[model samples]
Each structure stands twice: as structure tokens, then as C-alpha cells.
Target: MLQLNGCAAGSSSLRLAKDIAENNRGARVLVACVELTIVAFRGPEEDYLHTLVGQASFGDGAGAVIVGADAGVHYPAERPLFEMVSASQTVVPGTDHVLTMRITEAGLDGHILRRELVPVAAENVERCLSDAFGQLGVGVEWNDLFWTVHPGLRAILDHIDKALRLEPGKLAASRTVLREYGNMLGATIIFVLDEQRRRMEEDGEGGEWGVMMGFGPGFTIETMVLHATSNLRKK
Candidate 1:
């Protein structure tokens, strides 16, 4: 059982799995995640909006994933649920003060979420994704892959959409999950993936290529590409 923190943990989980595959080929690892964001609300301080952002937009939940050098062992090699292709992460150059969740007298508390966050994130979003694709020697059209992004905020998603010029509906899954469940903090992206999995099982939709991305404190950005394999049982 490995634990990860921050809202970006969803993406980081995949990154960690990739690490295991690299060092111990054929070995497997599972990334389990959950968040009790409500616990951090109204802690030692009282900011209604921030607390509402935590309470109204976040809830408690847990999720997990198993990754390894090959999918054959779990599902037929021909069509495993997901094949992790590549991943990358970047830390904002000098914007540490922008977003923070700190440990203080009352446990954990989110500091003031700055107004510059969206603009700054918008400026860096493309470069971050481009950096990931470039590292993997893959050329990507935003419309070419299924997107599973962190549903941080409607405005943040808007800023990302406008900045990346993504196909208008590319982020629907993320937004849908947000509307249905608010933000489950670190567990949100996994819930988004679960949604994709169920969709694939029921409708054989969402194409072959998938892109997973998330942002967390320290203004860290994470990205990954997953290719779907058809399982006769579902697809």
C-alpha cells in the first residue's frame, strides 16, 4: 500500500507505476488513492469561500490501479484495460507561493488560492503537455486522444481549454465528473478514469488513445498517455 498526497496524486500514481516497470520489468505495482478534503476545512482558520471550495467541491473517496511490465498476466495481452505509454511531470519555476495546503496546528489547511493561478497555469499548460509528448516522441493533436483532466474548477478548466484550444468537448468527462461528484481531491482523476472504463464497457467509446493530466500544490503538472486494448468481454 503506497500513499500519495495532493490533488495531483491521481497522475502521480501512474508515474510511480512507470517507475516500477522500469526498474523491475515484469514486476507489478498498485497505486491506491483517496482524500478526505472535508477534514481540512475550517481548520484553525475561517475562510468561507475556501472552506466551501473544499466542502462543496470536494468529498471523501478512494480509488486504486494496478500496473506492471505487461498486461498479459491480468488480461489477455491483446486487450488489456490500459497500457501506460509514457508520463512526465514539471514543477513551476518559481511559483511556490501560488497554491498550498499546509500542515499547521489544526492538521492540514489550504492557504489562499491566488488569483494568478489560472493565468499562470494557462501559460504553462501547453508547454507541460508538449514536454511530455516530446519526451515520448509522440505527436499529439488535442482531439486525437481521450482527455482525463483534474476537475479543479470550472474557471480553471475554462482557462485550460482556451489556452490549449482543445476541441470544444474534449473535457466533457472531467467536467461531468465534477458536476456529479464535486472534487474528490486526489481521487478525482481516478474517478474520471473509472468513468471512462465504464463507458468503454458499456458503449465501446472514448477511442484508443488517452491522455491523463493533473495539477497539484507547488503548481506541479503531471501528464500521461494510455492506450486502450480491447477486451472481448467488454469491447
Candidate 2:
């Protein structure tokens, strides 16, 4: 058990899982991410539109996954709940001013919901995604990967979709989560990842290519490409 907590902490968890799997034999790790953002930002001052947008879109969520070194034996639950290909984080040159949160007597206060956040997020996401895909060593395009983006804001998600020109509804999981659950900060990505697994299970779909993205303070952009452990359909 290890703690990787932050706005894009989900990406950190995946990176650790990848390192453990590749370096240590028989290593198993349980990564749990939980967010209580609503409570974290509770206060009347949150009435400002800057805070209101986030409050309206986020909710409490927690999720976990177990990762182990590959061996012959396997669980019979069809396939792994999720597989992480790679995770990487990037902080654009000097965009840190665009997104940030601070603690004050009024409780946790945030400076997000800025107009600049959407563009900065969209830009960094592209750069990070391109770099992540390069790590996969696969001839895959961004459009080929399933997206499980942390739904930071509806507008930001839309901006990414439009900026990347992703296929229509590619960010559905994030959008759906935002519509129903809002944003859970670092824990939001875990919920999106779980939602992807659930969708695949219900649809009887099996494909490895996936890209998970999360944006947070430091104007950071975190991304991971997901791969199937086995030929899911072949399994």
C-alpha cells in the first residue's frame, strides 16, 4: 500500500504500478484513491461563480485496483479491471498561475474556473498525450485510444475535445461523470477509469488502446496509455 494523493494523483498511482510490475517479480499493489472535494471546499464563499462551477460539477468518489506481475495463472473474471500502459506528467513553461488552490480561514479556497484554464489544459493535454503515446512503442493514434479524462470542468473537457478534434463522444465517460457526479479532484480520474471498465464489461468490448488524462495545480498535465494484459478478445 502506498499513498499518491493530489489532483492528478491517479496518474502517479498508475506509474508506480507500472514500475512495480516491470521491476519486481510477484509484486502486487493495491492503489486506492478517494476524494472528498465537496467537503474540502465547503463554505459560503464558494458562492462565487469561480467556486460554484467546481462545486456543481464535483462529488465524492473512491476507487481502487490491484496490480500484480504477469504469470500464467489468472483470475476468471474475464480480464483485469484496468491495465495501465504508462503515466507521465507535464507542467507547461509558466502556466502555473492559471490553476491553483489555497487554504484560508474561509476553508479551502480555489482559484480555478478561470477562462485561461481551458486553453492551457487543452494545450498541455495534447503535448502530454503525444509524449505518452510515444512511450507505448505502438503505431497508435490519439483517436485510436479510449479516453478516460478527469472531468475537471464541462467547458474544459469540451475545449479538449474540440482542440484535439477527438471523435464525437470520445470523452463520454468524463462528461457523463461530470453531469452526474461532478469533479472529485484527484479522485475523479479513478472514477473515470472505473467507468471505462464498467462500460467495456457491459458492452462486451475488448481493446487495449486507451489514454487517461488528468489536469490539476501547477497547471500540470498527467496522462497514461492503457493496454490490455492479454488479448482480451483472445482470452
TM-score for all models, in order of appearance: 0.86, 0.82
List model 2 lDDT by residue over 59-172, tens digit each: 778877777656434434434555665667787778767777776566566676468888888866777777777666677766766788988788888888888888887788
Q: Show the colliding residue pairs in model 2.
A: 57-182, 57-183, 58-182, 58-183
Give candidate 1's TM-score: 0.86
Residue range 1-235, candidate 1, lDDT tens digits: 4233477888887788788876885677777887876566663355434555455556888888877776675445434577778888888978777777776565665653648777877888888778877888877787777778888778888988998788887788888889898878778998888887777678656677778888888888887877777651243
lDDT of each: 0.75, 0.71
**Positional deviation of 164 in candidate 2, in angstroms?**
1.6
lDDT of 1: 0.75
Candidate 1 stretches with Cα past 4 Å from truth are 1-4, 41-53, 73-79, 112-114, 232-235
Quote the positional error of residue 232 for candidate 1 in Å: 9.4
Regions of candidate 2 where Cα sits further than 4 Å from its true position: 1-6, 41-57, 71-79, 230-235
Worst 10 residues of 2 by lDDT: 71-80
Best candidate, TM-score: 1
